[model samples]
Target: MVSKVTTVAFQGIEAVPVDVQVHVGPGMVAFNVVGLPDKAVGESRERVRAALSASGLALPAKRVTVNLAPADLPKEGSHYDLPIALGVMAAIGAIPAEFLHGYAVLGELGLDGTLAPVAGVLPAAMGASALGKGLICPAASGSEAAWADRDMDILAPRSLIQLANHFKGTQVLSRPVAKLHGNAGPLPDLAEVKGQETARRALEIAAAGGHNLLMTGPPGSGKSMLASRLPSILPPLTPRELLEVSMIASLAGELAEGKLTDRRPFRAPHHSASMAALVGGGLKARPGEVSLA
Candidate 1:
């Protein structure tokens, strides 16, 4: 029997759906994963094997084939581990196949059956919500996923055994609450600057009118200091802007403790930063500093 689970592949900040199809059937005893998986995804077989063994379940002594569909999309990241493992579990009847029907799953699996947090959970949660499905992510990332929508169903488990128990009705997994990073005191205020009245006026105008301000001055003339204080003078992000900023930060793995914050981002790239570092273009096309800004 073939059992399927839903997950996502990220393109920039967008989460594209991918189906994990696992088939455990009669054949030579071998495990194979296919469908354009990158190195991290290709290695999920060993991780899944060891995790299941640690959880006291072993792979069936038959041929096992895991296919990530659509055949043309290149899958990346360790986030596929949980979905693939769950697909195999359903295939072997370890968990009821129908139990996974309405959720999207993503997380990395440890050799000892623990679940590790993976990046892009927020975007994946948003994508799952768009599909009218719930989200199953690692416990560490549950707070981040909870920001997708209040009414969306979310199941966050710390390990394979914990999730299995939840599915088997031995334990119940509660939805995680969305978290905000506590304010680390107040931001550096423009009032702290002793001089540079002209520069301060420019900063105020830029903050009030939302216009760009370019600062140029000799070293120790407060150019960098004034720039650092700009966020303090600026208004807090609107709800939509907060989500947009947090999503970019989430995809970049910069959201500390899976918590969001209302403060505007402040990025100061070094003079030696490369084009790709500033603009974001690599083999994976990850979000760059500008996107986080």
Candidate 2:
């Protein structure tokens, strides 16, 4: 029998749906994963094997094939671990196949059966909501996913066994609450400036009218200092803006403990930073300092 599970593949900040198909059947005993998986995704077979063994389940002594659908799309990240594992379990009748049909699942699995947090949970949650599906993510990312939609169903399990128990009706898992970062002390205030009255006026006008201000001065002339205090004078981010900012931060893996804050972002890059450092470019094309700001 072939069991299928829903998951996602990230392209930039967007979460594109991917189906995980697992088949356990009569053949030579081997495990294979196909469909344009990157190294991280290819290695999930071992993690899933060990995790299931730790959770008191084992793969059958038959041929097992896992295919990530849309064979042309390149899949990356460790987040596929959970869905692939769950797909295998459902194929072997360890969990009811229908149980996973309603959610978009993404998380990393430890060798000891624990679940590790993965990046892009917020965007994945939003994509799942758009599909009218719920989200199943690591417990550590539950707060971040909760921000997607209040009425959306979410299952934030700590480990493989915990999730299995919940599905079997032996345990009940509650939805995780959204969290906001606590005040990290006070922000710099422009009122404390001893001088630079002209620079301060320019900062205020920039803040009030939402205009860009360019500052140039000799070293230690309070250019950097005045720029640092600009966020303090600016208004707090609106709810919509806060969500947008948090989503960018989430993709960059900069959200501390999956908690978000309302303060406007303040980025200070070194003058000698490279173009890629400022604008973001890498194997995965992750967001850079400017994008985070």
Candidate 3:
């Protein structure tokens, strides 16, 4: 028998649909995740096995194949662990297939059946909302995903055990709430910084027009110190900007306490950093300090 559950493959902020199809066939025991899975997704096999064993379940003695459909897309990250495991559970009749539909799950499984948080939950939940689907996410991240579509149905289960309990009707998973801040932090005051009259003028212009300023001064110049103080005079992050920055930070796994960023980012990488790291479109195509800020 075959069981299917919906998940997502992330490319930047875009979430491509992934259909987790678990097929069990009579043969020598085998388990695998197919369809362009990256190192992280592929490693989920061992994690799922350990989690299932810890949860008092075992892979059936048969060829169990997990196919992440739309095979051409590149699948990355351990978020696929939950859907793959749930698919197998449904296929093995451990969980009812009826409860499997309409929910998109994203999480990483620990050896002891713990539900570890994974990146990209916010974007995945956004995609799930667009598709009129509910989200099943880790406890740590449900608040983060809750920022995308606050009213969307979401299940934030703390662990595999809890999730199983919820599925079996022993408990209920509650919807996560967005923790995005609507105000900026109490920034450092600007009155304490004494001198540099001309430099302060340039600083004001940079803040006003959002222009670039190259300060050429001696070693004792307050370049670093002055830059650190800009957050004080900067405007508060609106709700929209907070979500954008938070989404980026979320994908980078840098969100703290599920708190959204309220202050404008001020990233000043070392001047000696490599070009590939500074520019976003380099070989790695990663967001450099400019984009991160």
For each candidate, C-alpha RMSD in Å?
0.9, 0.9, 2.4
List clashing residue pairs in candidate 3: none
Q: Give the TM-score of candidate 2.
A: 0.98
lDDT of 2 at 54: 100
lDDT of all predictions: 0.93, 0.95, 0.83
Q: List the residue pairs that clash in candidate 2.
A: none
State the lDDT at 118 in candidate 1. 86
Candidate 3: worst 10 consecutive residues by lDDT? Answer: 279-288
Q: Candidate 2 on 43-81: residue-level lDDT in tens?
A: 999999999999999999999999999989999999999
Error of 3 at 209 (Å): 3.8
Candidate 3 lDDT by residue in tens digits, 1-293: 99999999877767788999999999889898899888888989999999999999998889999999999887878899999989999999999987879888889998998888888788788889999999998898888888888679899887788988998988987787778555545656566789877777778888888788787777668887788777777787798887777766777677765557678887879879887657655422346666678
In model 1, how large is the Cα lDDT of residue 282? 93
Off by over 4 Å in 1: none
Which scores greater on TM-score, model 2 or model 3?
Answer: 2
